[model samples]
Target: MTDTPDTLLDGTHTVLTPEYVEFRFTLAGIYSRFLAWLLDTLIVMVGTGAILSGLSMAMMVFPGFASALGFVIYFLVDWGYGIALETAWSGRTVGKRVMGLRVIQRSGVRIGFYHAALRNLARPVDRLPFLYLVGGVAALLSGSYQRLGDMLAGTIVVRERRLKAPSAIGAAAGEGLLADPLFVSRVKRLSAEARELVLSAALRREELRMEARLRLFSALGTKLQELLAMEKPAHLSDEKWTLLVAAALIPAPGARTSTGARAVA
Candidate 1:
């Protein structure tokens, strides 16, 4: 998947997958990225300090060992913080969450540990010559606002869209069905992981081979039907049925959690 240069003027990065499933993202601006970085740095420092403070008594016993242990603690906190959180939280660190930002692969999917590590490992180079100057120049030149780390990692920081109700889910009348309080209530009870699966499958259905797609959706539709104790309409395909569930699970505005970026995670 790659972005077309024609769509860059508005700062939108569109990925057209091999099977033509498309995704769009608004690239994070430098100011917002910087702020996110600042917040994350402070948090890292605080966390590192707290851990070190607990070892104060150990330091008195062995000054040399304490210095070495301090370095290790700093290293783990500095490196492990982003890697662990990004992998677990679907590309969001605490600072990124506060700033409404997320890191995603160029393929428009949630970042894995490899992606997180690459980006975090490159941060030193991005900070080269002081204060993220290298990274800033790279972002300015890249047009999509990607830093050196992002370029190396094949990932981009993006502004998350506000959660909104789906009007339709693949020709199923989601809006109309959502009007039924019982239907909405049942769907709202779907676990976050299940809802994420439903949406991710719907969004990427075009990318799967036909047999795989059919089998996958059929199983999901059957399981979901059983769980929700609801019957699919006689005419709706399994894929369409799954899409309907996906649409129903999207949270309205002001909701705390999200269905994720194109149901990424």
Candidate 2:
């Protein structure tokens, strides 16, 4: 694998895979997660309450002991159900699916039962003293939306929904771009700050107006030039843009042509 530096978010250092960096969340992700949680909790509570009520009625014969048993059963069913759903569906509980949030491994892989177990198990600590106060603090401190349990489990919460595509990048295969050896290697080698800047800039591209975009490109170009310590090209072109990006990831010994000898900035 490539050895790129970690990305910093809100002062936290986070190592990122191309997929993770590329798919970074925005305000929409936060809203989606909240909605999903609300829906999922409502569904689970209603379902569980109905079952528990029936169990309580049946246990009327042994009031005290039966009530205790019912409580235990409820806890188990709720926790187990959530775990099963998240593990099976890659970090998505019913609520998350509806809201389009998902849990994933730090490496950007689908979360499995083991990882899910770790995060769920830590829920007690995260929720202690208040409604996820500890967990919230951890998430705020984390580069990714990782609560205490997720951090310990090496997992992250991410947006399931895709962002609006950047027109400049076109509709090339996302997988193919990430899979390129040169791209992967370069990404792996970035410093956390630089990586974060790159990721944030990429994600924000569509939001930028023309002037802002030009300004950003110029700033990025300057930063890249400093990073590579290369001479500035007499003129900038699309090929130059591609090469600069490539150069950020890999060291090109000399200029090479795709079909024609296009000049790269």
Candidate 3:
């Protein structure tokens, strides 16, 4: 699933999931991402400046406590700045927001505190030997334009955009093949919630963001593969397989509609 700019279609990286969702994220290039990092650094510097100013004033009043306070502020400003802002702002610090960039899971999942922490914790490594030289090389060479921190965190930087529902189902719209008896049995074995989840995703596949659709279908496809104790044919995409399974389990009208259903995020 790794994709470099050279492999991108019309300069956009496509993330496909087994659920038939496809997300086309325009990767934030090394230069833009660096600029955003610089902005965040400036913010950190401002906070540091304020803390130092306060510490200097306090040093005259309480010289003993000044040293301790400086150390604490230094640690917090160096690390806590990024962690606190990213966790609270859904992966955006002041610089990222200003640069119209955001951090998100490569798989299209929402980032959590753990992800933010992991990425930030690895920041020092990314900065090894100076001005993010290691991270710069990694981003330039890696598919998804990821730095070491992003790779460690399974995250990516993408330009922010409004998520719009698709007007029609793209890959999810197709005639499903008849289910094999074994496949049918496997389908029946799934829990009601699981079955309904697949059906719902299939029904609303058209309206989902490409990345989300791909993720859903990929996950469902893997689940089906496990249940059926079979491997997917190389020719069949995850969405196709999941749709076939959905068709077998749900034969209701409009289940295979050419026009996609409106999806609610």
**Residues 21-88, model 1: lDDT tens digits:** 44467787788888888999999989989998998998888988987898788868978999999989
- Lowest-sum lDDT 10-residue window in model 1: 1-10
Checking candidate 1 for backbone clashes, the offending pairs are none
**For residue 172, what is the lDDT in candidate 1?**
62
Q: Give, for candidate 3, the lowest lDDT window spanning 10 residues.
A: 163-172
TM-score of 3: 0.57
**For model 2, how does the per-residue alpha-carbon lDDT over 1-265 read when each residue is reduced to its tens digit?**
2221221222222334332323233212334555775687677778778887887666787777876876677666667877899987657888876665677666545667898888887877987777667877777666565778888889767654343324433322232544556555655565644653554455455545666556666666677556644444556542244334543433233547332111100
Candidate 2 regions with alpha-carbon error over 4 angstroms: 1-34, 163-265
**Runs of candidate 1 exceeding 4 Å displacement:** 1-10, 19-21, 62-72, 167-234, 237-242, 247-265
- State the lDDT at 37 in candidate 2: 59
Instruction: Report residue 257 deviation for candidate 2 (angstroms).
Output: 42
Cα deviation at 24, candidate 3, in Å, is: 1.8
| lDDT, residue 249, model 2 | 37
TM-score of 1: 0.66
Which of the two candidates, 1 or 3, achieves a greater TM-score against the reference? Answer: 1
In TM-score terms, candidate 2 sits at 0.51
